[model samples]
Target: MSERITHRLVEVPGGRIHVAEQGAGPLVLLVHGFPESWYSWRRQLPALAAAGFRAAAIDVRGYGRSSRPPRVADYRLLAHVADNVAVVRALGESTAVVVGHDWGSPIAAATALIRPDLFRAVGLLSVPYAPRGPHRPTDGFAAMGGDEEFYVSYFQAPGRAEAEIEPDVRGWLAGFYASLSADTMGESAGESVSFVPRGGRLRDRFPKGVLPSWLTEADLEVYAGEFERTGLTGALNRYRNVDRDWEDLAAWDGATITQPALFAGGSLDPSTTWMAGAIEAFPRTLPNLTAAHILDDCGHWIQQERADEVNRLLTDWLRSLG
Candidate 1:
């Protein structure tokens, strides 16, 4: 959207992944979270380039212009990491600072873990590596539900997430994004994430009648269009590989990332904060972790909700490395 970030098709593990890059210096790969395309980083691309880093944002396996395959198995953890590795190689860089958000955060961590040599540094917005994460992916999901995860467990059901998300994706996404505690999302806002139960059965999760205030009709429409075109099947498939992901990470044990790392958490983000001591456990996963700052004023969409602040943190952190 700004100065037209360069677009190219990167030959990755499965197929050609569409990537957009700007600037020309050390590389920074900005990987986005679920339900988002590379377009989410429109604001940061040029700015990072201006600051002198060859910044690239890519459409992860299932989203945006990148090629999407049919099977949920296709979006496995290893596949995701390999795709990132392929992109890094295609860029002709031996290593790049990898920055990620939400689902991208784990993938970034996994890339640094599964392919440590491929990354020079790591930064995450809204998510971090729990000692349990690299141990096994399913462990994270399982750890969420000590006994029964009526919340996330819903994802495992066949055709469950897809069915629920597709029928009302517009309203769902709009409601989810807009409802994010505005108090948490001051300015930095890109992709707002929230969890809501299917139908009106889980009012406890969405107290304000399923739709929140910030999600405007326009925002809902944008989400609706994307879902309508892509369908939730491919996206939902991400959840299906839970167990398979664990199996893949089984062989890679106790591998802590030694790369300089930056971890940012949204204090109001239930995904991270709700986990109790999870945020504090990050350093154990990275041998050279430097800082872990929780943006007290933000929610899940840290980049979008707190862009200027997030940008400042990232730029400053990168400069610190020099």
Candidate 2:
């Protein structure tokens, strides 16, 4: 059975954070990634709540009803880590299990990295928590990727990506989501430039078509509506701060996430292929990782695409943590 979800605004450091709450017990904070809201965790919320945990999916700063800082620098990883801490504190809990996906993965990991007192356990989906490299992460990207116009490199300049993507929000998001899913990229996936176009609009980088079954027309509209209201400034800003995040995390160089951790990703997710090295070494970086799962025939939208499996894995992990 599904638990009822409640929406509320909670006061935090910079501004109010909008959260979707359900159940009651130990707090479990869900932080969403770019181009998404708290709704990304819709499938997992009720499941966790029914499992006897207080589940709250948060709209990271700059997205959804959360505070949007005017400056891109304000979207730094530490800033996001602070937001997680604040939200946990606001919930009257000294510690909570923190779960994140996409960009939210690092934030959840960082919260566990810097303030384990607050985020007791960690759950990372899609993206793994790899330790910082010796140099700036962007510098490494430049060396490896060259002038390939990688999406992250393209997102460097403010307003560039927003200008390209925000115009046709529905089409852009639909294509973006589809391009990264198992439906589009399968088997021979790594060699395609379709995910990142060279000197072209984001829409040009993807095939023009209907959204996949995983993303219903209604789901697309909800995402489109949110981006329509806020534009892509805040969300894109996350990519903009990659280097800054690298520098900010320098103090904890070689530090590993010591909390009990679990990771889940789609077998066909591009990030899983790209971060193969890091994902393979996740056990080394996260020695406490209890389980790492890859769902077959799944895609980037793991929670939404394989909600039942994800819920089972997540709840099982949560249960083991007790």
Candidate 3:
């Protein structure tokens, strides 16, 4: 079954961040990603809360019921890392288990590294660790992509990506990844009652863009509502800062996370797998990553699609530590 979660807003560094919580023990601070709200963790919040850990899911800066700052830079990695620190501190916990998915994973990891004092451990859901401390904008562009997948390059292309996805707000963003099938990219159209990544025209052994089939209409609605409110600018802003973050993180040394780290990936989820080879960079940077697991059957939304397994894996990992 799923856990029933509760929502509320709390004040943060720049402004107020909407946070949802349930149960009580230590603390599990969940930061949501782009086009997603605290509601994303609907299944985990109550489960963890009941498990004795105060499950707190906070909407990132510019999504959902949280404050949306017009300035794109406000959503930068540094600002985001600071938000995690501020949220954990604001919650009155010296350190809490921080979990994040998609864009939230990056902030979660950075918080573990830069503000280890404020975090007990970090769980990176889909997007794995990318060791580009001082990232160059040039280093983070569409290294090799096609027209089907645009946001990566589209986000930076003046004002194009966001505009394109606005058509069927729910479908556009949901379709971004829900269009892929068990075999090919964007081919299984109008079959599944839910969403799948498709529509891009391409023919290669690796069809550049492939969305898994976990995002459903209801799921897409949750995401579309947020994008409609935020207009994808604040969310897309994450990509724009590639060049600036590299320079900033490279200069900071004390932020290396040496705590017990866990990396969970969906073998089918291309996001993490895309550059997952970079996982080697993490142990070198943190050195204490105790375990890493790959759900060969799951995808980007592992926590959502494969929640039972994810929860079992997450809970077991947490237990093993003690």
Evaluation by TM-score, superior candidate among 1 and 3: 1
The runs of at least 3 residues in candidate 1 whose Cα sits more than 4 Å from the true structure, single-residue gaps closed, are 133-149, 184-222
For every candidate, C-alpha RMSD to the true structure in Å:
4.2, 1.8, 5.1
Per-residue lDDT of candidate 1, residues 92-139 (tens digit): 998888999888888888887777777888887777676434554455
Error of 1 at 254 (Å): 3.4
CA error at residue 293 for candidate 2, angstroms: 0.7
Distance from true position, residue 84, model 1, in Å? Answer: 0.8
Which candidate comes out best when scored by lDDT?
2
Q: What is the TM-score of each candidate against the true structure?
A: 0.85, 0.95, 0.83
The residue-by-residue lDDT of candidate 2 on 40-156, one tens digit each, is 898889889998899999989998888899998999999988888888888888789999999988889998999987778999999988898888877765665554556677788
- Candidate 3 residue-wise lDDT at 25: 73
Please give the TM-score that candidate 2 achieves against the real structure.
0.95
The local distance difference test score of each candidate is: 0.71, 0.84, 0.67
TM-score of 3: 0.83
Cα lDDT for residue 128, candidate 2: 82
